[model samples]
Target chain A: MKIKNILKGAVFGVFAVSGAAHAADVTLNALFMAQAAYSEDDIRNMTADFKAANPGVDVNVELVPYEALHDKIVLSQSANGYDVVLYDVIWPAEFAQYKLLDDVTDRIDDKTRKAVLSGAWTTVEYDGKYYGMPWIADTKFLFYNKDMLKKAGFDHPPATWEELETQAKAIKDKGIVDYPLVWSWSQSEAAICDYTTILSGMGGQFLDADGKPAFNTGGGLKALQYMVGTINDGVTNPNSREYAEEDVRRVFSSGQAAFALNWGYMYNLANDPAESQVAGNVGIVPAPGEAGVSKASAVNGSMGLGIPTKSTHKEEAWKYIQFLTSQKVQNKYAKLSLPVWEASYSNPDVIKGQEPFVNAAKTSFAVMAPRPTMASYQEASAVLQEALQNAMLGTATPTDALNNAAKTIADLQ
Target chain B: MISYRKTVTAWLLLTPMIVIILGVSGYPLIKTVYYSLTGAKLIAPDLTDAWIGFGNYIRALSSSNFREAIWHTTYFAVISVGVEMIIGVMVALLLNEVFVGRTLLRAMLILPLALPTVVNAMMWRLIYNPDFGALNALLVQLGMLDAYRSWLGDPATALDMVIVADVWKNFPLVALIALAALQTVPKDLYEAATLDGAGMWNRFWRITLPAILGPLSVALVLRTIEAFKVFDIIYVMTRGGPASSTKTVSFYVYQEAFAYMRVGSGASYALIVVLISACLIAGYMYLIRKHGEA
Candidate 1:
């Protein structure tokens, strides 16, 4: 009987060892990109700091290049199992189809919940369920050179579409500017973003709140027609044909265009007198309309961190998420002026901290609105971009272009 | 016993080569043919188990972009190959002369060939830059036009300029082949031509031309294949732009497969391109065989 008991104990010990093997410390593999936020060295140092703070937890972080990140993560994340990752907010629907992300609403605390600001946190919520933790927030606004506008007899930024067009015409007449408007009209993603803003602002929408086709209506056509007017009225350049995000920013910084519509990130360069030809006078203004009447500026670009549902290290991945979105870490990141983490903006140290960039978090984040959440947003954006491209090219009247896009979206639905 | 061992050693030496060719060349060729039939977007890194039939090919056939690309690619191949052959033969004759720097000059001539396609294209793009490029400055200095013109940006001039970049990049290969073929020609034939009171032109036409036909034919086939699949120059310079004016078939295939992620469609389109290329190669082979028989 004593021998048998000893044998049973040994068997129990073997089972215990196997279970402990499954209970080993989880090491979460994270993919992040640093260039947009800070220099690679700065991000690595920050990451090391985060690692030191959490001992015994191994965090494997991969720094993906900015241009290649969007396509790479989207494709790989679709292949079933992954631990945790950073992804563009535009891509959640595509990734969620694989059922690979955790719903972290329960795990989030008041500290984390309070850190995110109004309209920014909405990007992570799809179908009223949170699938990701917000990392960075970005949206579109107007970047006008204040001195140029001042010289053109405008004391303030354009108050409405009429004011902007009038100011551009004035700038053109004075022979001070080569082109009044310069922005992306290329066949890539920018074309979509620019078009959607114009369409939404004009009371045109890709889909109604009920998700029915809505772009082919009067409002959509008016939005498109206004762009055609800009192109034809010589406010926007014919060279806008060759324009892209880089080209627009380059030309705008060089003082070639009077008023430029660009994202909040333009603040970094526009404030730099060395990189910018029109630096000291650059001004940021919300694309103008009566308050609460303008199509709320659609959420432009934001990135989120989330753990895949099939990850080997769910608990550790959540901890890393906690670290990345924490006010402490976000405050450190805010030094780079990336517009990441709304909570960091309110932190006195983050606001007062001097980094290489001229800090503009307070101003840039002031009048921004979140992008609408819809499953079919990707398709909708494309339709709107096509309309804008057509309008800008003068191939179709704006009304015709918007109506056609709306009809197309309606057909798609 | 020694002869038997030598034969065994020769076969043994060739075994690794046989394995390599079968693995790298043969396997890929077979895989490509299979992939050509299936609608596969090689760019969509997000695929698990998705298969579509000749649907991609059907879509590619119906697509206007594919048709435009085929037309542009054909025009490019015919023009570039014909021009290269004429220029190559002339350069070969020039190099055959006993001149100072003849050896040195010939060595220098191969420099373009040595430079990578990507590097060569980058240099040319700068040369054509309208703002501060060397080409524009030279033209402006010479009073060729009233204002600085963007060579690659103007839709009218883009295709022609790209063809020029490609020809400049590739014509060296043709010249080297022609020169090598010229050396293999028996000196006695030239002597006979001279004895017959044939002038320089006649000697070049009758003896020199006939002697270099094999290598010239080979060069032509290779140039034609390269020109048909020309993607790099167009991609670097125009990106099928100033409108979709300079888009070649290969670039179109890349856009369809990679950019748009219409994988099955892209696959079929790519397969179609390969089939056309195969046909071209087969035709070249038939011509070479017929010429040899004659």
Candidate 2:
């Protein structure tokens, strides 16, 4: 039957080639940016499935380097060169601030709307208007090398920062590892995520309840100081200051670090025996708590899809967006990877029989903190990251750096 | 009459470049200037763009963040350019001498100038890494410090480290340019200066220096302009970080526009950067023209 289908496909191909001049083709220009998640096969399958779902819509999904996507999308949006593009959850405010995408609340049907993860709609919402639907839940979590911990007399991941420090120090001192813990300390989005972990676990707010840059308060200071203290105590690698997520991943994947505070997407990499030095020797858990509170790793990894306000094919684009974000398609994506839909989370296929993702899905949703919603969060985060980096390097004390960062962020407002 | 026609033809030949300039740069300049005047938030839903006349300028001027950014940026330019030029000139002069392996040395000196800026930034950022970096490892082994110190991670060392990286990366460009111009200077002039009781320093100051001054000044201006707009390395390595000790004007503009949704504010600050850059370029051009007249 497969051979017969292949022959039939070849005949169709020959017919299409012969009738190319007469038949009008529809091309849907699209963008896919998954820097930390999704292998090439994952992207190819996703693209293929998308094309299959809409047989007539010839989707041209070209992958771009994640770094260039934002600048390119924003710059192009001003002139209407790009029709539809993927966006990180953090970017909707900036995009909506520019009035780039059309409101999609009306376009999305009840079924599609309900299928998406709760609060997912609010993520892309700006000023009480819907813009994009979530693509995935790219949250952060704590990952530990179970084998390393077994070697060092521990059964499970650390429950508190204090426990983490003790185990990390024990491992480091005994020469179990050169550096026992690692995190994304690079001065980029990763820094923002790391800060989220520290701040949330310590019960700190990045900004006040009244929408102000409010990280210099008691809670905020304690959070910043705790993260800084981990390095001061010589637990994590100090070069974490310069580590991009990949650097931390490399260290963790090599089976060196006993504990890694990292993104949720690294589960596959940490457990693939062919790729990871310590495959199946890993245990993933929610990040450590502080102030008797569970750690809240910042929500990232998800891309939001929206129609451009000036799009010539607004109706068609909306239809595509609606269809793609439907429960059925969302379930299919979950089959491929964890789709950012409430229905997909409970889908039996997502785990492939893994307990960690199941635990993460349950725990992460309870404490998943999205990047701050304020329009100036990006700039504020950049300033704050620089300050944290400074403190980590001992160039300035955390108090001094946070004070300076606070002053700088307040100036922007 | 024929000369006039020929002039017209020459102008017609140059018209393509003018069209390109207007298309590529001129339009954005005009648009940016317009946006700078009116508060153009790139993503705001409100249709009524409040044309607060000079509001952006007032805000930018009063902005403490902008002030600190300008201060840090200028300091970087002054410090990095000074260091780079002096070192570059010295290197150029050393390479200018007829030494063993001159060909190989000249090629090797240009290697850093050849590497892409992003690669250079990544490589240097790695070397400057606090843990597992060669610098910290060497320092620890040598007992220079009790622990690893991240060079670009601390606010105090971040700026200086960036300056060092910038100088290390850029001094070679200046040197290569200076070297080319130095080689063009007749060697007999140096021999003449030497015969006239000019010692080593005297020969360099009286003869060699004068010959290369014109080209070197041009190189200095170019280097200064490039250094003034230091964005990528700072953006990549530290990201104006360690509490923004290295935030240059370009990075600030980028942050304001893209990071913050303050588009009008960003455009105005961009104009400020443009005005400063224009003045610097004009001064350099004036110096070059003056040297030509001299």
Task: Provide the TM-score for each candidate, comma-separated.
Answer: 0.78, 0.83
Best by DockQ: 2
- Give fnat of each prediction, in order: 0.03, 0.62
Q: Model 1 residue A92 lDDT? A: 64
Give the top-scoring candidate (lDDT): 2
Compose the digit string of candidate 2's lDDT tens values, residues B187-278: 78877777788899887787777788888888888887888778998877776766567788899898777755567778899999878988
Tens-place lDDT digits, model 1, residues B179-278: 9998899999889889989999898888889889998999998899889889988777766765466778898876665444445555567678888999
CA lDDT, every prediction? Answer: 0.69, 0.75
Best by TM-score: 2
Candidate 2 C-alpha lDDT tens digits along A1-413: 99999999999999988688336656666666656665556656656776777666666666775665777676666676655677777777767766777777776668766666765665677787788776556667788988778878887778777788889888888889988989888777787787776677777777787777778877678877877888888887877876777778778998778888776667777787777887887787777776456554444445677766766666556656656655676555552246666655666776565667667756766676666776666667677777877777777788998999888888767
Badly placed stretches (over 4 Å) of model 2 are A1-23, A52-56, A62-69, A126-129, A173-175, A206-209, A212-215, A290-302, A313-337, A343-348, A390-413, B1-34, B43-49, B94-111, B126-149, B278-294
